[model samples]
Target: MPWTLPSRPSRRSLLAGAAGVAGAALLTGCSDDRPAGGESGIPLERRMREAAVRDSARLLERYDATAADHPALAARLAPLRAAVAAHSAALALPPAGSRSPSASPTGGTGAAAPSAGGEPVPPKPAEALTALADAERSLSEARTIDLAGAPGELARMLASVAACGAVHAYLLTSTPGATS
Candidate 1:
């Protein structure tokens, strides 16, 4: 037979082989044995949950401080404050003993500290209410974003909390007594 050269591999064949190698690497590279929110790493879900919990605690603290500074507004703020407290409690991490290493400390869950020696004079009722409404609006917006990344149960809980915050914002801004 006359001398003949072997045909070279086509571009399509080369690409197919490359793809198969990449797929196999991906399949074997991931390890499911790592603990959830453990030393190896904190999953995205845990990070989002922790952030939500921290934000809820901060909101509760702010409400408490504002109420303390303006005792006259406490009655009007009670419902909103209670709502924030409920959200904080719901999102709070388990106790330190049972929590993972990646979990945030529970210190944020405590009562608001007095400002320095004594409480400063509070802002005007209208200003304070406006500030609270703004904060609630922000929190609600944040929760809405976090909901996208959360697990099914967490997403539902976050949706409920976001709705509560939005309602709280509306009520705070519109209530006749609060604007005074």
Candidate 2:
């Protein structure tokens, strides 16, 4: 006779399903219906903090890649990269998986980007340090306003991350081998 158990799920199946849902939620948090522009009447400061995470992740990749290309800049950049990575982790932002635009010489639009092979592009450096600088400033300015009414620790963390962004901007701007 075949050995048969109850039809109900065993402990493992229930745990597995819960784990799968949790993983999916983690991966898809960006689309959580948080309105953009604070157009939802949400304050701009809240928006700035969220934007900082996304911008930081993208810039971290670009700077890290560009720094990698120039041997001299790489050592100086290690700490900066580590700081960005830490900030990204704190914000629960995804890591930058895309290759640098410099890597392929295919222009700033790397194969990783969705655009087609040929397109006239602006003169912006493939490295995103400049954009990071802008985002940092925006967040810093927003922090002055009475936004994010509660969650003190989170607000403080965002402020600290914004400061890190300022430092990053200074390093990227003044450091040798940083692209225009």
Candidate 3:
């Protein structure tokens, strides 16, 4: 297979993205620019949503391979994956791609292999849930910060994401151990 270069960023696209982010910052005061070591100010809600989507994709890929054993679990997980995909699309985040389990990761000698056909893979789920929770926690902290200082839409959107994250966490934890 031939490697294709990523498309160059267009000036208009760059400006538009910057404008959205800057507007978000100006509205929410969550700008990336801050005094050294200060808060990142990036909205946690958006971050949480993005993270959840990514986690969902990875989990779906794993579930897809093992769905034969747990049809109901796979079915339940399918909607969750769809929800994640929808949320990711709404936020304009990149989608996950399929890759073989044997592919080597850049920094390690041992490749990160998919588990044996029916082996329970707890760590991925655990790590994903933990990250999702952390993102929600961060959003909560951001919400507590004075929104009187920034833009209304940014603050509102951030708060919305916090709520979404909480809901996502509950959904993830409540799912069965062997989903289809």
Candidate 4:
């Protein structure tokens, strides 16, 4: 008897594979010598990557502050905080000639957010959530504006992260179990 052919892969699997391939390419293929902007001899892409890391760190700080101040909400914010941590890891620029991504220069689990240091968290849980949502929205908008000038792979990554940030903003404020 003739053997049956293998079933076709689902659309979800295909897209996931494509994304993995694309991410690998970007990680291993970012080679450029041109300097778009450098006040202290840093390339624009490097600056952008650093900025992304810094912003994510700040967001993580906000998440941590909210969780610490409002232990009751910690469980709810944990997943979102983990996502931001992963974003922080992914946004880091690898050392020269390295292909894989690394964590930020701080090397602190969640302790080195420069700009977020000393910022007071709102006393009310709702207000704190609103602050987090505002931060996410602001960062998302900034990333969207930055997309026009970013090169190929960086632009794709930035767009994706920006979209994630927008989604985070919506999630932070939108009521749970609300009817349509």
Write down the lDDT of every candidate, Cα atoms only.
0.70, 0.52, 0.46, 0.76
Candidate 3: residue 156 lDDT (0-100): 52
Give one digit per residue, the lDDT tens place, for model 4 in 1-180.
Answer: 999855998898999998997676555445563565446776667677778887888788888889999998898889988988787777675544654454444434546545625468899999998898999899898987766566567777788888998998998898877877
- TM-score of model 3 (CA atoms): 0.33
The order of the candidates by lDDT, greatest first, is 4, 1, 2, 3
- lDDT, candidate 4, at 135: 90
Best by TM-score: 4
**Tens digit of lDDT per residue, candidate 2, span 71-127?**
555666678777876775565422235233433222223322322332222234434
TM-score-best of 3 and 4: 4
Q: Residues 78-135, candidate 3, lDDT per residue (tens digit)?
A: 6654554443344333213523354322212322234445334334554444444444
Candidate topping lDDT = 4
Instruction: Tell me the tens digit of each residue's lDDT in model 1 across 92-141.
Output: 65433456665434435355444344323347877777787888999999
**With candidate 4 superimposed using the best TM-score fit, by how many Å does residue 177's alpha carbon deviate from the native?**
2.0
Root-mean-square deviation of every model: 13.2, 18.4, 18.9, 10.0
Model 3 scores worst on lDDT over the 10 consecutive residues at: 103-112
- In candidate 1, where is summed lDDT lowest over 10 consecutive residues? 26-35
Which parts of model 1 are misplaced by more than 4 Å? 1-40, 93-122, 177-180
| Residue pairs in candidate 3 whose N, alpha carbon or C atoms collide under 3 angstroms | 27-150, 27-151, 28-151, 73-179, 73-180, 74-179, 74-180
